[model samples]
Target: MVLSDLGRRINAAVSDLSRAPNLDEKAFDSMIKEICAALLSADVNVKLVGNLRKSIREQVKFKDLPPNTNNNTKRRLIQQAVFDHLTHLVDPHAEPYKPKKGKSNVIMFVGLQGAGKTTTCTKLARYYQTRGFKACLVCADTFRAGAYDQLKQNATKAKIPYYGSLTETDPAVVAAAGVARFRKEKFEIIIVDTSGRHQQEADLFAEMVQVQTAIKPDQTIMVLDGTIGQAVESQSTAFKQTADFGAIIITKTDGGAAGGGAISAVAATHTPIIFLGTGEHMMDLERFEPKAFISRLLGYGDMSGLIDHIQSITRDSAAMKETQKHLAEGIFTLRDMKEQITNIMKMGPLSKVAGMIPGLGGMMGGMSDADGTEKLKRMIYIYDSMTAKELESDGKILVEQPTRMTRIAHGSGTSVREVEELLTQHKVMAGIAKNMGQNKQNMQRAQKMMQGPNSKQQAAAMQKRLQSMGGAGRGMPGMGGDLSQMMQMMGQGGGGMPNMAQMQQMMSQMGGGGLGGLGNMFGGGGGGGRGRGR
Candidate 1:
């Protein structure tokens, strides 16, 4: 039920305006009220929301109407205007790999502890290698224990050359050696994996400046944890002010609600995110596409980049293509759902996946915050409790049995109510999938809007939206357009796994029918309280 908070705001505004037959003064005023409320609740900056409201008012009042204009036209125009305002906030310059030809690249990874800097380096190297560049890894983190060993291990896996000095205490020397070796080896790209920071590490940044000078790198990338929402902007600024960052890599995307904040950070730093590390694997990387990303935030469709990553690793085009066909056709079953979840687990955590989408988070606004994340952990526990047959079979048992529901509730430390909620959500999603099959245009338009320049700007607007919402945005993909389309797709088990909606459904039904009720009974309601659903 995670929808983009921003998208929901826009939709709410439209819905309010649509309630009236014409753009009367009162209707316009009411619409503005809804817009202001939704934006503010989304954590958007108050001043920004105010300015947008003013523009909306002007468009409705002062602007000239076209010949034969009606309330519908007015409403649509207002929708577009609001969308434009939101879009303007996304920072498009954050996309990194749209490189200039013949420009040697120097990218560096920086983030807090446990942010997966070492793994990011290998993924970045693999990214460059795929682009036909000879890449080198610089283990400049001579201080952090096991930092050097970790980078080297991933480098070996990628089969890319690397340089690090075990004896030298000076990281500068190690950086210099790595650079010199890179040049000698004719490497077109060099990635420096610095030690993880303890927030605003001035000395470390100074050292990074020196390393950048030694290499004169064309691009400097700040690696960020997907789970570090509000902290991402400040941390990125610290690095940018020191080393002048060129792009970003939002890593550990399979982790938490950090994806929303990470996207918001892109606008704050005025730099494009070049890549996203969906998993720890070398191939779990993708070029940052604002539209695709925004569409995901809104719960529009399966991520093409995610699919591409899977295809690269699986090398089973036929299976993938067939799966997609089945998904689009709404032919999914519990068996398909199990396979989908297994693959997604292999890729990374569910929360990270949820934040990448657009409107779904808004719907899920009630569940997430800057400091806490329990969505993914809950999902893992629920799924762990399922037997293979249970995962593959639908309506076999516990679909309506209170005793079974109680058992599941106890087993998962969740509630029977929560288990039922999950089932209800799944039913809703299956309906969306069926609807998506019928309304191809809305889905396509949503997809296009998400991948285009609008998405980049909307992401920027999201940062501004953050202050309004109070909690950072979190949710699943594709929530606004046609719920039934999403539901049908879920039934077919799209790209990553059974859609989050289906997962919720299956988990709920299973829990309610068996020991799954334990989760809700103990934890009070499982994760069913994710958001305030309409």
Candidate 2:
């Protein structure tokens, strides 16, 4: 079983238990049995699965519950226990080394051949480069033929600075020279890509030691193939003994059925996994967080990860800044909506973005990326069909004139209903923007605080406030309290804007309609209608 299949099976078991009329120990045990079976099929270690089953049973203790406890309460306890245990199964209670700005942080990569060390090195470099770090790559894999050429091509495509010696036969010599040169140039993040053999031979261990000695790296990361299954344990252990790597990065996570096993095996070794290579794309790497990973795995969505992606992608966009200014004033015009849509397009594939939304993921589970992207493009066409006056208005003028809607539909080559649906989506967001405008002063203050010197401290303080207000389980129903608290947090300058929890609540109100009539397109039993151009 793949990770997605495992997640769906486990989720179905939990959901079945939740819907059971008799919330007794029998049903609970059945759910546990199903979950364990699913995990085992996914290649998760038997001992780990057994421990998880035992832990869930101990935590829930269905028989020990109060006689007056309602089924709802009992269900929540069971679900929470499953979520916590699944999270614990992948968490290595250790923190990865964080690179400091303005300083050279040498990150060394080690793993067996074909584990994707070369590609991952460039990805890591680009990741930091996007985050305002002066990141560069050093290709020191002399054992592998064409390693320098491959690194050069990747680095050139990503536009990240790189240093590699095509003529150097000794990996250590190239690594030392690259690091020394980058340090002299004051590059903040220097990543050294080392050579790997097919097997953990003595020569490979000696080569790794020599490179480590040459670079004296700030952090050493082992790249593991997610398809290695239980073998990940022995492989990681051998590398750990030889290189003492500070962190791990698992590649091919999006492809293999043994991904779950690889994660569990690595966690058993007590070394933190920093990232997972989800795809071959340069932007496919995802930061590893146990809770967020498990949450997304179980189809619950990951708000924090979405926020990080948004921040990383839109950090320097002037258009985004302009939209933020407009949002501060409580104005969300069609142009602003268009800009938001464009940003979503830039974020990545629609399937991946949908998974970050609470209920949207499961709703669009069967829709392919091409279909979703086409749906979004049609909405953009509607915006493009509008006149300048129409785009600048709050979409009320278009509604006042039915002919304008028809004109937009004709011009955009879409149906009148899709045009209307687009307006509906805009209306929902416009209402949120108006509410935000009502609290403009608070939003301004929050923005300033976030951009100020003590921004990190202020952000942490606000996060604590959100958690206090039950932001942790915002995916659950009845989020009105959380929404109000989020607005209040904005008012007090505690947070910059409405968070994922707040956005989820708002999107739920539209029945998942925010993304260019996406709710209508997917929720109305079909893909609705395609434009003439499509």
lDDT of each: 0.58, 0.78
Q: Which tens-of-lDDT digit does each residue in 1-534 have in candidate 2?
A: 237788889889988998899889899899999999988888888888989988988898866778899998888788878888888888888888999998999999999889999999999998999899999999999988899999999999999999998787999999999999999999999999988764448887898999999999999999988887777777787888788988999888777465765766566678888898888889888898887778777777666788788877888899889889898777889899898888888777777787766677766758888877877787788888999999889999988999999888888888888888778778877776766566445434545656679875765565565456544343222223433354332233332222334545655664633442445555543224555664
lDDT of 1 at 25: 68
Looking at model 2, which ten-residue stretch has the lowest summed lDDT? 489-498
Give TM per candidate: 0.54, 0.86
Which candidate comes out best when scored by TM-score?
A: 2
CA deviation > 4 Å runs, candidate 1? 1-68, 92-104, 112-114, 130-134, 157-160, 198-200, 226-231, 252-264, 277-286, 302-534
Please give the range of 10 consecutive residues that has the lowest summed lDDT in model 1: 512-521
